[model samples]
Target chain A: MMDFLTNDLLLLSDSAVRNAIPLLLACLAGLYSERAGIFDIGLEGKMLVAAFAAGAFSAIAGMPAYDGGWEMGAWSVWIGLGAAIIASTIFSMIHAFASITLRGNQLISGVAINFFAAGITVLIGQHWFRMGGQTPQLREGQRFEPISLPFAESLKDVPIVGDIYYQLISGHNIIVYFGFIIVALTWWVLYRTRFGLRMRAVGENPGAVDTAGISVVKLRYSALIITGILCGLAGAYLSLGTAAAGFGKDMTAGRGFIALAALIFAKWKPISAMGATLLFGMLEAIGNKYQTLDLGFVVLPGQFMQALPYILTVVILAGFVGKAIPPKAGGEPYVKER
Target chain B: MNKNLPKWVDLGLIPLLTLLLAFAVSGLVVLSIGQDPVEVVQVMIKGAFNPFGIGHTLYFTTSFIFTGLAVAVAFHARLFNIGGEGQAGIAGVGVALVMLSYDWPHWSIALLVGTLAALAFGAAWAAIPAYLQAKRGSHIVITTIMFNLIATAIIGYLVVGPMQGEGSQPQSERFPASASLPDFHEIFGWFGLEFAKHAPANISFFIALVAALLVWILIWKTRLGYEMRAFGHSEKAAVYAGISPLKITMIAMLISGALSGLMAVNTVQGEAERLLLGSVEGAGFIGIAVALMGRSHPVGVLLAAFLFGILTQGGAELQFELGIPAQMITVIQALIIMFTGSLENLVRMPMEKIFIRAGKGATS
Candidate 1:
């Protein structure tokens, strides 16, 4: 019973980290955009489009040489990642133009972006691949392969510490490590850097930032660019880094919204965002592990587990769990004083 | 800055121009895909207006009407009710529960109770988000999005577990024959008019029309509507005048949610005769596009809903005839939303400039 429990713990923790990477990246992406007073509900859309771009480009680049076909090197994944970043950044620019330049409703602009991504990805995917809106299955050389740490194999039999290090802390694709690095980078950028300070100030008081000789539009645009790049990484992770062969239609599902929930649960803090996403990820891991988990007294349904993150977000938003105050000028477009 | 143009410019001309821009962009997309834009349009119109296709078009129009009205009602109070999708989905379960409870003796009685069930369930789904927004200052958009996901999980659990049919599908058993709503074929047959036998359009279409009429009256002809509009315009000003923001928010959302719920009567009780998973099929999101393009007016919503209904039915035909994906419609819908909802200023600014110049020339 003890051995089985330990084994289950290792497996669960391993999957939890894997699942949390995309959410973490997206959550941090939201952090950058929302901090700059550009509320982005389109994170899911950006990630989805990026996923499609990455999958499609990588599949094309990695296609083997035939009578007339061109073969590419294993560096195809980098090309795919670059395509994802470029596509997502262009998509984010649309939101920036609508919400910033046109001074339109930010929420409505975000909604449009989401719908646009959802539609365009599938339309282009089907047009290119003709696989019913799915990219071709990526092979080993075409996708991100997991990298085992140097001591992971030797450390596997070294009792609890070694097992924990081997199972929970090692053998992940490069993006997973990048996700953690981004959490740290995000913390540094949001709290430490001068640009970060101005970005936060813009979200809280664009008028003040404008008065202080900073261009609110430039700050907001730059913030959204960062948001776009991070979302692209998250999307690439979903398609190229994960076990899934390639991008499928609507594959981002609701992770964007879930990341938004995590952002709120963290009260816009970076470290807490990690914790919140990990908790949600663990819930997802548990749900995937058991169809219906049987306890001594009651059986917990998987649906309940799946719904818990959303329920918790509502509770937090309602101040039952805790108060979640957003940035003051979060959803409003800035107009210069007349 | 120019406010000298007639109301028709704002109401009619701007939306028309915006729609044209959206269609132009969509045409470019189609052209990029190697399909002739003119041919695509021809096929779409023929497919949506043919005798057999008109019924499906009207059927789609009925649901769009309800969801569109739902979003429009909330828009009056400045509340973005994104939870229409979830509210409608949960309402399907409520409708199934009521229709499956017992053998009702008549279709009229079942229809009445089923509508009430839909209204109650949809309102209940919206209630939490509304309450949070009212009392706690939570952002309604985020909360509604979360509720949509949760509602999906709840419906998935119910349909697969307790509500599963014997045929191994994740759907409930069909409601009793007596509980089925009258289709357009039967209703038109009573008047000696031959309608398509398999068209899904039904008496629920009439319900949607009635709902639209009632919404018009409620929004334009009532004291509550005045207060809701006051709150929507400016919360600070409304509060100074003793209009309660909380009251307006809650009432507007409840009404909005009920309208969304009413859509289930068309899909679950009228067309499918059973509660199927994914019955809403993104109609809730489509409501946002409808409301935006309609300028949040009931009559405008009706027209927009009909237009979207044609796009939907026509897109299905495009898929069948031209090998183009049905998502082509979604792309068009998204463009419309972006242009009409978010980028209205793009056309409005230029048009306002032109109109101002024209008005000045006449005066000079």
Candidate 2:
């Protein structure tokens, strides 16, 4: 057991953190929208559109044999990232339009958005590439490359500390590093700024904001836009970051939904969102690592571990760990006259 | 929005108009891909209505009816049952076990036990989320969706590990012949007419019709349903009237789950004759659209299910005949739901204004 925990688990922990990046970004994405009283369940939808956009842009711009194509380069990843953000923004705007402007049932609107994304991505991708809804694999230099820290090679043999720095922290895609920075920035912007306070107030009591002469619609729209940005980054990272294996149909693979669970699991706080994401991601990585690993006692099913996060969400919501309260005005469209 | 002079326009005209607009937009999309929209429409209509295609259309309709009723019942109670997919999927296991374990002499006896088992399993799956929402204040929508994913993992394990057929395929053995539901062709053959040959449309079609009728009677004629509707309209008022929110929430979701589970009888026993992975497809998701378009009424649900059946069967022909992608059908379905539910006010507001103008004209 000691041998199993030290070496095998350390490697598991490293990949766990790497997998945690997209989940963390997605949870943070949901933080802003729900904070402003707009219950956006379209996180999955937004991410899919972005991933498809990123993949299509990269495949189009950097394909080696395409007509008049430039050699694949780092700029392709940047262009892909930009395309993802723009595409996700447009998709989220439709959600904003229905949930906000139309004052429709937020849940129904969200379900529609999810379907729209799944269909549109596959439809367009197959039409463009003739590759059964798969984007061409990115060549070297066309995707994010793993970066090395100053002493990563030298620190490799220094026991636990070495693994922590060299294996876990260093040599990750640049997006993983940026994911952490975004988490901190999200926490700061949410807790430290005047805008954050007002946004939280809108979720709690949109009536008070409207009475105070603030534009509830405008505040909510901006909140959703921020949500779009984070969701876009998560999607782009899935397709273009160093961890990427190119985009395929439904490649986000319900990570967005898992992130939503983490958002509520974190009690809607940004820092807790990060912790929750990492914990969930670690659960997944461990699940993959311990496939039918037999102990002296009884063998465990890997799927049980893979399903831990969702089970925990259900357990948490069932009041085992106290109430998981959402924003007070969530799922309700703000109507001034009412 | 509810204070309208004409009930017909509210329930009938708006959905029709929005459906037309949805199709117009879909036509434009098809046009963008250089396919002729007129030809597409013609092909879809012909494919869906042709004798051969009608069997498949009705088979899809059978599945949709159960799911639609599942959603409609829950929607009436102000609860969204998004886990119908998982509920139906889980129900497949129960259905398979019932048929495989029993050496029943007749199809009817096997179907009876299988149907009950499916309901029990689906309701058992839904009971957790309902309990969480009723007792612990968890949002039903998110919790149900989460259950959907959990159901996938469970069925994955069941099909692969515990219930795997001797064959390498990740499916159970084909169901016993005595347990298999009779096809439409067999039934029609008794009367000397050739119909739905080799198609999977079965006795479940009549059962679906009966289920819709039962839903109508239950919602309109039962005291329990009154309390559910009362609670949905105003929980505070229902509490004052001595109705229990906890009781209603659990009961509503359980019934909803049973209805969704019934869809499995059509797909697993009636059609596939075995428990296949991904057997539920996306019918549960489409149930939301049917419920919305049906206005959560049984009659409306039936009509909407049929309309969806046309689109599904017809969309297949469109793909096979014209090389148009099947995703176009999904896009159209999404647009229909979005337009009917989310942008309903867009159609309603204008229509309401027209009715108001006409009312004033008639009076003045």
Candidate 3:
């Protein structure tokens, strides 16, 4: 019984970690933009475009060097990552221009960006690949293959600790580790750096930041650029790091919104964002494992498990669990007073 | 600064110019995809307005009107109720359950009960989020979005588990024929007018128009409407005038959700005759574009919805004729929303300057 429980834990934890990476990255991306006073619901759109770009570029880059031959020498995954970042960054700039430059409604701009990304990606994908808005299946060279941590194999024979270390903590793609690094990096950037101070200040009170001689526009733009890059990583991970070999239509599947919910549940804190996303990821893993959860007395439907993250977010937002106060100047466009 | 500009310019000329800019950018998108922009436009126009296509266009317009009104009503209360998609979806289930519950004797009785069921279910779906936003100060935008996903999950569960039909498909059993709404052919036949037989345009089109008229009166002529607009414009001021934020928010969202639910009358009962998964098909999101283009006015919504109806039908035609993907219309819709809603300043600034100068010269 003990061994069975441990094995199940090991399996569930492994899949949980994999599921959390994209949410972690995107949640952190939203943290940057929203903390800088630009409310971005377009994170989904940017990530989707990036996923498509990553999938397409990787496939093209990994094409055989010689006719009628398969080659695995191409560093196509890295190229795909680069393309994803560029495409997402350009898409984010459109949001910036509308919300920041034009002084428009941020929500409207975000909605438009989401639709624009959804449409353009599919249209371009169908035009180029003709496989019903899906990119070609990526080869091994085109995907971010899993890497075993040092001593993982050596530690595999010990006891429960070894199994946990070998199975749950190691053998993930580079992006998974990068996602953890990003959480710490995001904390360092937001709390410990001078730029982070101004960004936070801008979200709370842009007029105060402007009075301090920092250009609010420049700060907001830089924050959005960071947001775009983070979302790009998340999107690329979806297509390359996961079992999904190529970008499929609407493949993000509301994960972006779940990440948004996680952001709110975390109360916009980086460390808490990690915890919130992992919890949601664990829920997803369990949902994937079983169609219905039997808890001795009643069977809970799988859909309830799938929707737990969103429901928790609503609970948190409603202050039933805790208060989630957004930044004071979060959605308002700042205009300099003469 | 240019308050002296005529209302026509503010309401009419500006949106027109913005739409033109959006179309120009869409043309570039078409060119990027290696399609002729001119030919695409011609084909779309021909497809949307052709004898058989007009019926389909009107059919789409009916749904757009309901969703557009839903968004507009919430906008009046300064609530961004993005849950219209989910509200409409859940309402489809409500519609299906009611219509499938009994074998009704007439379409009129079924339509009446279905509309009520739709309104009740959609409003019920919105109530939790509305309550959260009202009492707890939660953000309506995020809550509405979350509700949309939750609604999707609930609908998915129902269609597959409890509400599944006899077949393997993920949809409920078909409603009885007595519950089916009259199509355009039968309606026009009553007036001795020639109309296409298979058109999905039904009496629901008239219901949508009546709903629009009711919305106009509710927004422009009622005390609640005045209070709602005042609350939207300035919550603190509205509070000073004894308006309750909770009351306004709850009422606005319930009405908005009901308007959104009315759309199921067209898609579920009128057309599909069954509740199919993904029946909403992004019409709720398109409502945002329509409301933005329409300036939240009833007349403007009607026109904007008709325009979108053309694009939707024409898009299908493009898919069939030119091999262009249907997503092309979505791109156009996004551009329209971006230009009219977010980038209005690009046109308004220049136009305001011109108007100010012209006004000064005329006064001199």
Each prediction's DockQ against the real complex: 0.81, 0.71, 0.84
The candidate 1 chain A region of ten consecutive residues with least summed lDDT is: A64-73
TM-score of every prediction relative to native: 0.98, 0.97, 0.98
True contacts kept of each: 0.74, 0.65, 0.84
Tens-digit lDDT track of model 3 for B24-101 = 999999998899999999999999998889999999999999999999999998999899999999999999999999
lDDT tens digits by residue: candidate 1, A285-307: 99999999898799878999999
Clashes of 3: 0
Could you tell me the TM-score of candidate 3? Answer: 0.98
Cα lDDT tens digits for candidate 3, A15-101: 999999999999999999999999989889989999999998888788776632234345888888998999999988998998899
DockQ of 3: 0.84
lDDT of 1 by residue, B123-173 (tens): 999998998899998889988999999999999998899988888898999
Q: Model 2, stretches more than 4 Å misplaced?
A: A1-6, A64-72, A242-244, A293-298, B361-364
What is the two-chain DockQ of model 1? 0.81
Better of 1 and 2 by TM-score: 1
- Please say which candidate is ahead in lDDT: 2 or 3: 3
lDDT for each residue of candidate 2 in B122-199, tens digit (9 for 90 to 100): 898899899989988888998899999998888777777788888888788788899988899998998998896889
Q: Best to worst by TM-score, what's the order?
A: 1, 3, 2
In terms of lDDT, the poorest run of 10 residues in model 3 chain A is A65-74
lDDT of each: 0.91, 0.87, 0.92
Candidate 1 chain B — worst ten consecutive residues by lDDT sum?
B1-10
